[model samples]
Every structure is written in C-alpha cells, then in structure tokens.
Target: MSVWLPTAPCTPRTCAGHTGPVRGRLPATALLLAGCSLVLAGVVCVPVVMLLGRAPRDRLIRWWAYGVVRAFGVRVRVTGRPQSPEGAAHTGTLVVANHVSWLDIPLVAAVLPGRMLAKSEIRRWPVVGPLAALGGTLFVERDRLRALPTTVRDIAGALRGGSRVVVFPEGSTWCGRGPGGRFRPAVFQAAIDTEAEVRPVRIAYRTARTDGQAAGAAAFVGDDPLAASLWRVVTAAGLTAEIGVLPPIPAGTLPGRRALARAAQTAVASDSANRSAESVHH
Candidate 1:
C-alpha cells in the first residue's frame, strides 16, 4: 500500500500499487469543516440511533451512513439490484459481500439496514463497538472451533425471526492486490437451516488513476493501526466505491451448505477479479 501525505505535491507515479498522482490537500478550513461534520455525526446521530426502535433506528443509521460517506468525500456507485423479496416480509435474506475496508460497513448499511455479522474482537473497540452492538450486529468468535455452531445457530435464529443478515464470509480483510481472499464455508450453514437466499455482493474501490484503485489506501490490513488506516482514508484522493449486489441464490436450490458456500464464493470472487482487471486498464 502506498501512503500519500495530504499536503504532498500532485504528480503521477508508479509505486506500491499507486498508479496515479496523489491529490493536493484540501484547504485547512475545508478539512476542518469536514472533520467537524464527522464529529457531529458521531455525537448527535449515534445516540439517536440507540434511542429509537429497530425499524426507525436502522433508518436513521442508514441515512447517517450516507452522510458519513459524503462527509469523507467518498463517492460510491452501486451496480446490480439488491435481491430483496417483493413487498415486505422475507423468509430470510442473507447479504454476503466482499470486505476491503472498515468503510464497507456504512457503505452497505447505507443501502441495507440488515443485522450485520462481525468478528467478536470488534466488541472491544472504541465507540464503534457499542454502536454496532446496539445496531443489532452479530459477533462471532472466529478463533474457537467450538463456537462455530453456536454462532450459526444465532444467525439462523435471527433469520427465523424474519430479520435480514449481512456477513463477510471472507472472515478477514485483505489488501486488494488480486482476487480477494476465499470465503469460509461454515457460515453457510445458517442459510441452509433457514433456507435463506444468499445474496453475493462485491464492492470495488475505483480511484481516478491508471495504476491502481483507491482500495489500496483504505484497506485495513497487516500491522497498520486503526488510526493510521483512518489517516490514509482522509488523505487519499479520488476514491470511489463500486458496490455490486448480485442476484441471490436460494439455499433450497443448493444440495448443501458446502455447495452454497462454493456457489457464493465463485460469484463474489469472479466479480472481484473482473474489477481488478478493469482497474488496470483505466
């Protein structure tokens, strides 16, 4: 990943996945205003989401998510329709999207207000931890093998309750240097039990450059601290996220959980590979 200073001179360069010129800094006042907006969003909106019931809470959170994306000046272009049930009630809709950055949460949440499943460790994080918990996020202890069934049960129960669930089957995030990492199959069991539709989603970050996409800067990978990752996001220029919500595959159509996982993985991975190739030619 290439790190660029906000104040750096603008010039195209080829190094460490960066293919275009770094952007010049925003004016001090503009940056300050942006910062202030983010702070206010967190302070005012977070509490509001907590006080409201699930239906209204998710709506406010989703709208606030859109605001946060704009406040950071990140442009998002979504392709493909999200597979949703006609009218209202759905037996269960499982949204499975590729994970690149922490931003993936709000980007997707802005569209689907479903309960998201994240790793257990995130429960200890700063403000985000509590907000996520209150927003109905399901956390799984990925390291413990024995915990898998219980987690799957939790997801299945949520689905049986008529709530949509979003998950990153990749388990961990990666720097988008190639096709993204593979999806773990265990989570698919929840879909099988409830016979839910698995919706495969692909989010590609496109920067205005000929070399690489902006995901290189925003990816939360390796030993990079959360603060440093946040810095890279604020400083990077011409960042845009392209989210593709592919058609959903019904679990009843698949033979079993493993097959469901493979099918979803193939769809998500193929979309990611095509995006990687497209980024190179630009």
Candidate 2:
C-alpha cells in the first residue's frame, strides 16, 4: 500500500452510530435542505469570489463555510488563536488537523480559510468538485506513490506563493472517539521547503447529551457513503464541532520534516488528552 493511502479502522457500523439526541424528521429534513442550499450557493458564487482580493475573498469563504456548518444545525466552538496568514516575511501558513468527518473541511475553513489539501477524488465529486477547484484546493493522488514528490512540490509552491494550506495529515478520517491516525510526514516536507509556519489544530465532535463526550455521528470513516454521513449530521441534535488550535511550530526551527510532524502530532494529541481529562473531571 502507498504511504499516502493510509486507511482507518472506523466504519459506519463500527463507529458512526449516533447516540446523541436526534431532531424530528421534518426539522432534520429542513436542516438538510438548508445545508445543501448553502453549498450550492457557494458553488455559484465561486466566480464572483475569485474576482475579489485575497483578504475579502478569504473573509467571504470563511463566512460561507460557517454558514454551511450552521445550516446543518451543527454548532462550532473554536479554542486558541489561529496564526495570521499575513506574515509578509514568511511562506504561507500550513494548517494541519485531525480528520473526523466530511464536516471537518468546512469546519476548519470556517475559522481558517485556505487552500485545502484533499484527495484527488474530491475533485470529481458532484457539486463539491467544482467548488473545491475554484476555491483553490490542492489535490493529491494518494494511491500513486510516484505522485508524492510532485504533490509535495505543488504544496511547496503554493506555500511559497503565500497561500494558507489546510491539510489533514492523518490521510484518513478517524472516529474521533479515540486516538486518530498518525500524522503522515510527507506533507510536512512542503512546510520544511518553504519555511512555513505549521499550525497544529485538533478537531473534535461532541453533543450536549454526552456531557461533552466525543460524538461519533460526525465521523465519515472507511466505506462510509457521503449521503449517509450528511444525514447523520443533519439528524443529530446539539452536535458541536470544536476546533482546538495549538501553538504554531516554526518549520525552520525543526530539524527536519519527521521531527516537525512528530512535534505537531504531539501538540494535537496533548490537547485532545487535556480536553478528554476535563470532560472526565466535570
């Protein structure tokens, strides 16, 4: 298996069952419609957003992303500061996070709008494909080992051009109920090449009924259909997506990409552990 093609053990039967409070069919349907409408609206506005300057375009993208998540009745709570992308002296900011669900994409963009590092398959997705391309996503051919160097170079070029890039280094989506996949070090090479600032962000899903325990409803793990994941999110009541932005790791300060990847994984894992401990204490 290719290094970029890591797999997660989580599946719908094993991990995505929703134990949280659920909304009525009518309301859930309404939320589903609202979420789809927002996504369609974003796709339509892509051309217009492209015409704007960087700052305004980023602001618009952030707003659109937040709206999409909110339309699904999923609340977002962000902790810790995201490093600003406006550092003129440095390369772009590399935002790395743990993958939990399809919602993770917009959830991260809602706070830190940037070019996304995604699987090449997403570019072929129905409505999302065109939007991702227009929004400047960096797609990787994960199944092809030979494509790794080129992908890394593309990421490095984007960073050198000062584009903030969001990546899920786990390479696969986890259940968010336990330790996530390892942070693959390949993408970190881009940060190393461009001397970019690596922002380690941790994503978690929870519900009010669970007393802040991790929510499995949002996990889009192995072999999970997109429609199934979408339904789970819309039907889930009081689902909260939390973004924990840990301190930034200066790529220049790190000895190499492997060390940088480890440092980032440690920061994100430590934060997750701390949050879990707090939930237990309460």
TM-score for each of the candidates? 0.80, 0.92
> Who wins the TM-score comparison?
2
The sequence of per-residue lDDT tens digits that candidate 2 reaches over residues 1-282 is: 888878888888989888868999999999999999998898888888999999899889888998999999998887776655454465788999989998998888888898998889999999779877987988999999899999999999999999999999998889987678899999999999999899999888898776766798898989989998899999999888888877788899988999999999888877452342211101
* Distance from true location, Cα of 37 in model 2, Å: 0.5
Off by over 4 Å in 2: 85-88, 125-131, 272-282
Model 1, TM vs. native: 0.80
Q: Which window of 10 residues has the lowest lDDT sum in candidate 1?
A: 1-10
> Which pairs in model 2 have colliding backbones?
none
Error (Å) of candidate 2 at residue 178 is 1.7
